[model samples]
Structure formats: C-alpha cells, structure tokens
Target: MKKILIQQLFITTLMLGLSHNALAEDKKPATDSTPRQSTMIILDGSNSMWGQLQGINKIVTARESLKTLLENAHGNINFGLLTYGNKKKSCNDFTLVSKPEDYDKKKMLRNIRKMNPRGRSPIADALKQAAKNLPAENAHILLVSDGEESCGGDPCAVAKELRQSNPGLQIDVIGFRDEKEAQLECIAENGNGAFVVADNTERLKTLLDGVQAKARTIVNVTGTPVDGNLPGSIEVSIKSTHTGGTPSRANFSIYRPDGSNIASFTSRIQVKEYLEPGEYRVKAQWKGQSYTNKVIVQSGKTSTLRFDASQSGMLRLSSLNSNKEAVKANYSVYLANGDFISRHVHQDNVDLRIPADEYRIKADFDGTIQEKNISIEPNVDNNHVFRFE
Candidate 1:
C-alpha cells in the first residue's frame, strides 16, 4: 500500500510539470522577421515658410515640431531628409540632407535646425528628387509643405508617375498652414498615400505618431480620392483629341476665376455642374501629361472642351535677324475665333501643341512685328521661321 501511494504521487507531479511546460511554450512571444521600412522626409524650404502661423514663424515651428517627431521615432526604421528652395533662386533647387539609414535622432535634428527658407516652392521637383533617394520598391515618403508648387512642374503628374513606376512607393503629404488643400490632396491620392493638415505643433506630433506607427507595420498602404459630388448643373463634355482618341482614364479639376475648385472628377468622361456663367480654368491629367485651358461657360449651354493629345500637331516658331542669325523674339497665338491662346517672350525657338485649326500668328523681333495666317492640320508638325530683314 505504501508503494502504490508513492507511485500515484509521482505520476501526478510529472503530469503537472508537463502541463506547465506546454503553457510556457504557448506564452512565448513570436519573433518578427519583416524587413525594416524606410522613410524620406521632403521638407519645404520656400520663402513662404517665413510667414507667421499663430504668431510664430512657420519655419521655426516646423523645425521644432520635426525635431520632436524625429526624437520619438522608432529605432528600427531608417530615415532620410530632402529639402527644396534653400539652395538657389531656381525652381530646380533640391538638396538631400541625409541618406536613409537606421534612425539617428541627433543627426536629423541638427539637419533640421540648419534649414533656411528661401526662393520658390518647387514641390514637384522636390518630390521627384526624394523619390530617387528612396528604395526602388516599398519605400515611404512624407512631404511637409506650407504652400503649393510655385515652379512650373505639375506635382499631380509627378506623383502619378512615381506611383506608376513604383507601385509600392507611398507618399503622404502634410500641408502646414496651406490654403491650397486641393492640390496637395491630389498629390497624396495619386501617390498612394494620405493627406493630413497640421495647423500647430501638437497636431503635427499626433500626425507624425500615426505615420511612425505606419512605418513600423508590415501591411500595405493605399490611397484614393476624396468622395464628393459635383455641385452645379452646368454640363461639360471632355473629349480626347481626334488622333489620341478618348482617354479611358483621367482626372479633372475645374476652378473658378478666383481659383477656387468648383468641381473635380476621377476617371470620368463628362462633368455636369451648376457653375455660374463666367470664365474658368479646366485642368486635366491623362497618362502623366497635364493640360489646361480657359473655358467660357454660359448659363444654359453645354460647354465642350477637347484635349488634343493625339490629333494635335506641334507648332514651332523661330526668329532670324537681317544677318540670318537666330535671335530671341516674342510670339502670340490666336484661335480661329480671334481668341488669344498663349504668348511667349525671349524665345529663339518655341514649340507647343495646337489643335487642328486655322489661326493667326504674330511675332515681334527688335520692334519689327510680323503677322500671318496659318492652318494646322491634324497629326502634322509645322515649323514657322520669321525673318526680320
């Protein structure tokens, strides 16, 4: 009887020990083997950053907020920095302040402290340059800007190009004290990222916290345009040029004369709005190219706008002096209905697209003015040389 009791006790003890070992194994934390993500901060150093926001200079506020954000960033993620408008007066001003690597808070903070805002805001150029600094795939970009692209480049087009080329690239935009929300939002949507507004330091910190969390996750991120309905009853028809055919996919933004967006559409063929009768700007993006034209709308008539992407021909203008040498000149283009289309100055050679039509051309070189009528045929390239003899 004593042997039997001892054996039973031993069995119970062994079972308990096995159960505890199983439980311990179950509670062990799983290891994460995902690759560390990278992020590039595209900072705007335009002169407008000097403007006051809540009675503090925006540049100063941005630097402080960025410093705080960087200090609190995750240790595993790599970070880089790029800035524009600080190097020169040209729109191509962009500088890579830091190459992406493991987080170094002190180094990033020092670079932020040295940024001085000057010149025009070249948001598009900055974005392109920042994209180059990131990995070819699955890289993240955070653009902090106080204004829109003051340079000639189209940020929306550039964003679209980056996204198409690198489907894994994400580009979030932070618009600080920015009034051009539509433009920034477009960039974010096209770049497969989010757009957030930060009016102060606290808000910026909160936003950066979210971004940091996003950077650490292993999930894929995507973006889409904001949902909204057209406001007006005016009918607008958008058609591709005769040669290019109709664009299967495109984005449109219609602005009032005062530059306020009245309507926007994504991947749409026609737009119907109740816009007031006046002149407006119609901007369209298709297949990485941007087109803009001034449109006149009548109260009850449907306005038709055509984009001459394929059917349009190139019109090149050049000037020569009495000695038969190339000289800079000014030129103006007018439509068949006598409406001025565009003007160029100080150009020795100007090349532009014009829809198939009969129109008047004018050129001025050293006070000599020449006017002539010419016809542009569809799918043709035409060159005109003006002699100032």
Candidate 2:
C-alpha cells in the first residue's frame, strides 16, 4: 500500500512539471525578422530659405519643424538626412548628413541645426543622390524646398524615373510659396506621393508630423483634406504646358451626362473625386479661361482627365545698356488685352513661364521706357535683351 501511494504521487508530480514546461514554451514571444521602414529627409539649403515668413526666417522655421519631427518620430522607422545648397553657392552643393539608421535624436538635431542655407537649389540631382542612399527597397523621400530648381535640372522627370524604376519608392515635396507651385506638384504627382504648402511655422510642424506618420491624407496646397467617398474616382489635371501644368490654382466642376451638377471644388494641382461608376464631364477654369473634358469612371477604379489648357513657353528677359553691361530695370508683363500678369523691379534678368500667347512687355531703365510685342510658341525659349540707348 505504501509503494502504491508513493508511485501515484510521483506520477502526479511528473505530469505537473511537464505541463508547466509546455506552458512556458507556449508563452515565449515570437521574433519578427522583417526590416524596419526607412525614410530620407532631403532639406533644401537654397539661399531663398533666408526669406522670411511672418517675421520668422524660413531656415529657422524649418529647423524647428525638423526638431519636432524627430521628437515625435516612431521607433519603427529609421530616418536619414540629406541637405543641398547649405554650404555654398554651387549647383553640386549637397551632402548626406546622416545615413538611414536608428533614430538618434541628439545627433540628428545637431546636424540639422548646424546647417545654413547659402547655395543654389540642385533639386533634381539632390533627388538622385537621395535615391541612391536608400538602404531598403521600400523607402520614402521628403523634399523640403522654398524654390524651384536653380540648376536647370528637371526634378519632375527625375522623380518619375525614380518611381518607375522602384515600385515601392515615394517622394513628397514641400513648397513655401505659390511661386512655381505647378512644378512642385509635378514632382509629387510623378513620384507617386503628395505635396503640401507650409508657409508658416505651425503649418510646417503639422505637415512634418503628418509626413512622419506615413498615414496618407489627401491634402491640397491649402492643407485641407479632400472630401469624397464613392465607388469610383476621377482625377483631373489642367496644365498650361504639355510638359507641366499648374492645376493647383485651377477651379474644377463636375457634372453627370444629364447636365446635373455632381461636385464642384478648386484644384490644388490635381483634384480627385470619388463618385458612382458612370460617365461625367469635367470642366477646369484657369487663367481666366475654361476647358472641358469627358471621362468615364469604372467601379473600383480611378479615371484620369488631363486638359491642355494652353501651350506654354519660356520667356527670358535681360536688361543691358549700350556698353553691353547688365543694368537694373523694371519690367511689367501684360496679356494682349492689357491685363496685368506680374511686375518686377530692378532685376537685370527675369524668366517668365507663361502660356503661349501674345504679350506686351514694358521695360524702364532709368526712365528710358521701351515697349515690345512678342509671341511665344510651345516649348520654345524666347530670349529678349532690352538695350537702352
């Protein structure tokens, strides 16, 4: 009887031990072998960053915004920094401040603060360089620029190339002003990313936070979220030139085939609306002109409508004296109907990206007034030098 009781107790003890061991094994944490997402921050160090907004220097605002981004970044994402035009005035002026790695707040902040804007904007090349440093196939590039490319590089084309070659890459751009907003839009659109305008510090911080989150919110230049939810979508883009367009400032209205109004909203470069699968008419009002196009939307798919608002060309104007030396002059641009487009003062040279049309240019050099009529053709560069007698 004693042996039987001891044997039964031993069996119970052995079973309990085995069960505990099995439970411990089941509770072990699983390991994740997937790599972290990486993002590269391409800061624009162009001289124009010295420009002020609401009495604060843009560079200062950018620095503060970046600090906020770093402080609030997620641990799963690794960030790298690349800056251009910060060291000196050169087209090739850019540096890889840091490589994509674990977020080092102190080190990153130190490098960001030490940067100063002093050079030209090499946006296209900077995009190329940033693409090369991407450690992982799935990566993001955030380009912060106050101006367009000064190196004569086509950033839009480069962005398209990067996106097409790497299916997982996305590029987002931030522009400070409305000047050349269309070009910035092109970069974002071609790169399969988003563009947001941050003219002030608060907006910059908010925009940076949103970008860091990797949660895509369809926002326009005004920072407003697009409103729509339906079965299908239509994307409308109106451009003055065949190569690039400024749909950001265009007004859009959509209608059904029966002539009933469906939606009306202003475009921020490109506007997309979700609707029931059907045919619709899209009209775009831009530069005091209206253009219309027809598109058919299919369920679970997005249709695109691109309107060629007008052909566009480049106009380069320079002021020179009889001695062939550059002289400061005031110039005003007007349409054929005498509508004023823009005015510049005391600039020896100015480049105008305008729709192909008849234009009247009035130049004043030390009170010597001159008027000229010129026609611009699509994709042509018209260089006109005003020589004062």
lDDT of 1 by residue, 179-291 (tens): 67678777876776655566644335545655555454433233211111111123343456442565345677778777677557676544433344468887765554345
Local distance difference test, each candidate: 0.71, 0.73
lDDT string for model 2 (180-229, tens) is 77787678767766565666444344345545434212112233223222
Candidate achieving the largest TM-score: 2
Tell me how far the alpha carbon of residue 295 in candidate 2 is from the true structure, in angstroms, after superposition.
Answer: 19
Where model 1 places Cα greater than 4 Å from the true spot, the runs are 1-34, 200-203, 219-389
Task: Report per-prediction Cα RMSD to one decimal.
Answer: 16.3, 15.4
- TM per model? 0.48, 0.51
Q: Residue 206 of model 1: what lDDT?
A: 42
